[model samples]
Target chain A: MAWVWFHRFGSPPHFYRLATRLTPWFAWPAALLCLAGLIGGLVLAPPDYQQGDGFRIIYVHAPAAWLSLMVYVVMATSAAVGLIWRMTVAYAVSASCAVIGASFTALALATGMLWGRPMWGTYWEWDPRLTSELLLLFLYLGYLGLRNSIDDVGRADRASAVLAIVGVVNVPIIHYSVIWWNSLHQAPSVMKFGRPTMPAAMLVPLLLMLAGFTAYFVALLLIRARGELLRRERNAHWTAEAAGATATG
Target chain B: MSEQRVGFAAAAAALIARDLRLALRRSGDTLQPLGFFLVVTALFPLALDPQLSLLRDIAPAALWVGALLSSLLALDLLFREDAQDGTLEQLALCGLPFQGLLLAKTAVHWLLTGLPLVLIAPLAATALGAPYEAMPGILAAVLLGTLALSLIGAVGAGLTMSLKRNGSLLALLVLPLAAPVLIFGARATALAIAGEPLAAPLYLLAAFTVLSATLAPWALAAAVRIGLE
Candidate 1:
């Protein structure tokens, strides 16, 4: 029974319909939550005793960092699924993930640098998290570059899938090694996840922002994957019928 | 099954031997990257302050980076000739295990490109005024790091084998993945230059080498097959 549903979901036309139907469920809530979270975080959350309101960048920075890593995992998992199952929908989802992941990583880095300026007295530190995030951006670019360079879509999918899987395995290793390297150098940096000691007022808005960002990712992923599926399967009978119906409706 | 396994091993050995012979015959292929490594290292003193102390401070990382870039110079050619001549297809069709063949090929590439870099790294370090005490540490780190680099490079080379403009693309694909190696290798050498214990970074480099060796051949084989298809 589950296998039947799995295959049905794996079908491009069926997945396209499902994504189109699901996008709104994610998009509206994401927009509202983001609005609330931003207002709550920027205006209502108490300033830190030591860092003052400069730490407020955490509301955007933390969520973007979290989303960047989350999106890469999604991309890698979907790539692996596509490789193992040969599912076109999975490949489409993975392809959609790369751009979104890259943007979030760039956001994380930019916000991180901005936050670092006043807090650490420098815009850049060779801190572990910052360095690894930069590396993550490179990984995303490499994935996109590999995919774009290949002419055949299927070949590109397979090649990039292999790269993603290999990269997924390395991500943790890279993170840990960078941490280890930073410790060896012992550079004082602004970002550290040493403890969960945030007050409730701050924590709540941060949590809301995280949730909102995740929802935003899902909504964006669905919309992008739908377009990818439609374009890739444009000549298929179901796609043509679906396009015609949408056009007439 | 045992007989087939033996045959596979023999075939893999032959492949390695053939690659080594070819690399030796075209000594330019082996020598060019080493020359490039030497030139890059030599350029550092001329480009930067030629003060011995400053040179010594930067030598470990400079040598390592030079080695890395030079290794990349050879990686694009690792499978290029075979791929162009249809030897890759023949190897794919052969009853031998693709993973073993790939491992053997990677090993040969390391021997040609990586080993010479390891051998000459100390000389490069000496030329840059790096302390002689660090030579052993530099040797150990470069040996393991370059092996890991070759293994990792094989995957990139396989992926880009079918492309015409693969030189920069191969470096782009492989360099980020090779970051940990550069960190550990240069750190280990730097510690040795400082006359400090080098156990931690060396251990990490060893672990990286073992990990890359175990996993990369399969990925390389997969990439090669995709390229062939």
Candidate 2:
């Protein structure tokens, strides 16, 4: 019985309709939360004693970094689902996640550099997390490049899915090895993140921003997945009705 | 059951033997990446200040990066040739475990490309002013690191087998995935050069090789099947 709902969900027409219907549900909340989180973080939260306003970049940097990692996991999971079940909707979701994920990863790195220049006295540091995030960006680009270069949609989907899965398996090992390398080099000074007990005022806005970013990703994913579904299903008969319904309704 | 096991081993051996023969027939093709490795390492000294102290300091990174680029140079030979000649399709339809067949192919890749890199590493490192005592460490690190890279690159090769212009795309896809191998391999070499205990990084490199050895063939097999499709 549950499988029936899953199969229906995997169907292109069903997914298209559901995604279109659901986009507003996520989009409105995402907008409101991000607005609230920004106001609260930038205005409400107290400045850190050490770094002052320079630390405020964390509100953007932390969430972008989190989304960067989260989106890859989402992509890999959907890619796996697509490969295992041959679900077109899953592939569409995976495809929609890549560009968004790469953008967030770039945001994280840029913000990290902005924060690092004043804090670390350098624009870049070979810190493990930073290095791993840079590599994560490269991995995303690789996935997108592989997908774009392959001419056949089915072949591209399966091949990039294999790459995504392989990447997911390697991420942890990469992270660990980078950490080991960092330990060997042992930088002059380490940048400590939040205190052992972060104040609620500061923590609340960060949590709100994280939630907001997640909601925003879902909203964007639904919108993009709808378009992806349309492209993949151009020849399917239901697309005509779906297009018409969207045009009128 | 014993007979079936023997049959599997024989099949794997035959596959390895076939690839080795192909590699030998095109000896220049086999040697070309090694030559690239030598040139890449040689370029570093010319590009940067060739001070003995600086060279010693950067030798680990230099040798490891060279190994990486050269291995990438040969990755196409892993599956592209077989794919072009339709051997991939036959192997897929041969009614054997596809992953095992790929593992045999990857093993052959390691023998032709990876092993020679390992043998040449100490020479390259020494020329770069790496200490004589570091020779065994450099040798071991290269041996294990190159094997891990071959296994990893096989999947990339399989992924790109059907593409018309795959050289750069193959590097783009494989290099990020192979970053950990570089990190561990270079660190091990650095530790050897600095006269530190090399056990930790060497152990990590070995573990990574074992992990890739176990998993990459499955990924490569899946990729080959998809490319063939």
Q: Taking the tens digit of each residue's C-alpha lDDT, what string does model 2 give over A1-249?
A: 869999999999998998889999999998889898899899999998888888788889999999999999999999999999999999999999999999999999999888889988999999888999999999999999999999888789899999999999989888888887888778644566566677888888888899999999999999999888887887999988877756554
**Candidate 2: which stretches are off by over 4 Å?**
A188-190, A245-249, B1-6
* Candidates' chain B TM-scores in the order shown: 0.94, 0.94
Clashing pairs in 1: none
| Model 1 chain A weakest lDDT span, ten residues long | A187-196
Candidate 1 lDDT (Cα, 0 to 1) = 0.89
What are the C-alpha RMSDs, in order, of all predicted structures?
A: 2.5, 2.7
Candidate by candidate, in order, the iRMS in Å equals: 0.8, 0.8
Tens digits of per-residue lDDT, candidate 2, B1-229, equal: 3544336678999999988888899998989999999998988899889999999988988999999999988888688878988998988997888899889998888898899898888789988999899999999999999999999999999999889976588999999989988988998899899899999889989999999988998899999999998
Error of 2 at B21 (Å): 2.0
- Deviation (Å) of A150 in candidate 1: 0.7
Q: For candidate 1, write residues B104-194 as lDDT tens digits.
A: 8999988888999989998998999878888899999999999999999999999999987654788889999999999999899888888
Output the worst ten-in-a-row residue range by lDDT, candidate 2 chain A.
Answer: A187-196
TM-score of 1: 0.96
